[model samples]
Target: MFFGCEGVCLSFGGRRILDKVNCSAEPGRINGLVGPNGAGKTSLFEVMSGRYTPEQGSVVLDGEDLTRLPFHNRARAGLARTFQSPVVPSTLTVGEAFRAARKSHRPYLSKHDAEWAARLVHLEVSWETPAASLGTFDRRKLLLACLVMRRPRVLLMDEPASGLINAEIDELDLIMRRLVDEYAMAVILIEHRLELLAAVADDCVVLDLGRVIATGDPLTVFDDPAVREAYFETPDA
Candidate 1:
């Protein structure tokens, strides 16, 4: 497995958030994590990327133990995650953000390598446009581009399709699928966009109140009445 979490558990204040969660992903596959609000999907990603250390659990990457590593160390170890709300530099252009991250992460990249990362994320900006001027969709796209520049073996994305228009969402979906196919990278997606999730993910893991409620193919899990009752039903019911 490229990435796996063993017996992971996390708590905030007096409340236990993730409860002995176990998840694994290998190359050439996308894993989807779906749940209602406060289900701990973002927390799990935090643990996996070494942002928030779990109270009890182990994070393994490509068979190496990564439990105690700091976030930057984890990034150097080939783990990268994109945020639900990405912050872009006000003075930098889209291409500049990619260049800066590449320089920071790899540092030894030649001009050609930098250009490759830019192309990978579909950023075609000139070196002059400030990143602050880009629209919300492009800002998110630039963030993804930065993640790609990190050259991570396993990539985690949180709600990447949220708030995007139909055309932009379709474009993002195509980029993700293409990345997986062409690079053989492993992806873990936490997205509320069920339609896009079903289209991209090979398997799905559903969480409820911080526990695994179901795990299976996307269609099977989505169709299950238990999931519908726990997550999809109107609260008025």
Candidate 2:
């Protein structure tokens, strides 16, 4: 595993949100994290991304324990994450947003780096365009470009495909594949769209009420009786 959490446990207001949860992402692979609405998937992402501290467990990236590292520190250590919502700064122009991301930390990235990332994600907007004016799909592209510009080893994306149409999702699928197959970054994606996950994810981890229910290749994990019963079961069932 290039990046993973081991024995992670988390709670909020005395309610267990994650219990002994274990998940991992491999280099050059897409790992899908799936679960019911309250399955603690987002909370686990918080732990892995350092937004929340776990009572027990370790977050490891390339053999280094990052359990206690702050979010920015983890980002500096080759970890980056996108939110469930596309959060481009509304006040900034497309160029300004990219510039801010490039200059976010020391060893400032050059304009060429920003350009490369934008092109890689197929963001065709003009530099002068206001980030707030971008449509949902374009906003998603801009945010993804900002993160990839840093060349992080681990990328954690939360519901990136939300609000995207099928055609846009197809484009995103191509981009994700290139990121893994060409750039060799480890990607952990939290998504409800099983069709997209089935197409892109190399592995799947199913969580139910904060506990891992299954982990394996997507087909096998999705087919597991427990997983089907827990995740695929209809509300009326």
Candidate 3:
């Protein structure tokens, strides 16, 4: 089964944010979304996650039209997401944060599930340590750990590579590539870094100014003339 948007369109104050955008994400495959800033990548994420309703399109999950479903209902449909930055309680410990995020998704979440997520992110600190005590990378990892607790059918991630060092980036790349197989979920990753996409994504779609400019394997899409122009059409001096 796959999850995605079809002909999704949206706008704000007459300025278009998405135009007939279509892309599908399937289980056991990582779908990458790459484009210049303001290319509607995050906007599309919002639509797919039920934060925004497209003016003229539907968000479908396994043949059920989720276009009008609320975000909570969408979660019940096995859709999960992570933001550009970590949003965790400063006072809560690692385990507590995961437990709290786990509550709405499952009536009871075991320590094993939390440990599995922690291990996925390579978290080494004690579960009792306050979230505020962890470094940026660790806190971000905790956020990811929280999202994976529910084992959603699809996961939408925005800028998973942000604020990570080289080693951390490498670790995250490994985790992402394996997540699909381990969890049986479709993953949609949105980021600006081409290297990350090439290293992990099975396929990618390129967007520009609210419209799709190209879609294919990550390398092919990135190499498209339109994509090159969008980011690096400037004269080589």
Model 3 CA deviation exceeding 4 Å by range? 235-237
- Per-residue lDDT over 1-237 for candidate 3, one digit per residue giving the tens place of the 0 to 100 score: 369999999999999999999988999999998888889999999999999999998899999999999999998888889999876799888878877876755467787888888888688899889998988788888988877766778999999888888888898898887788777779999987778889989999888899999999988887889999996477679
Q: How close is every model to the real structure, measured as TM-score? A: 0.95, 0.98, 0.95
Error of 1 at 225 (Å): 1.9
lDDT of 2 by residue, 149-186 (tens): 98999999999899999999999999999999999999
Backbone clash pairs in model 2 (N, Cα, C under 3 Å; residues 3+ apart or in different chains), count: 0
Q: For all the candidates, what are their Cα RMSDs to the real structure? A: 1.4, 0.9, 1.6
- What C-alpha lDDT values do all the predictions have? 0.85, 0.94, 0.87
Q: Candidate 2: worst 10 consecutive residues by lDDT?
A: 228-237
For model 2, state the Cα shift of residue 6 in Å. 0.3
Top model by TM-score, which number?
A: 2
Candidate 1, residues 1-237: lDDT per residue as tens digits? 569798899998989999999887777799999999999999999899888999898999988999999989988888778889867998887667656776785455555765776688777777577889877777887788777765678898899887798888888888898888988779999999998998999999999988999999999999889899888887673
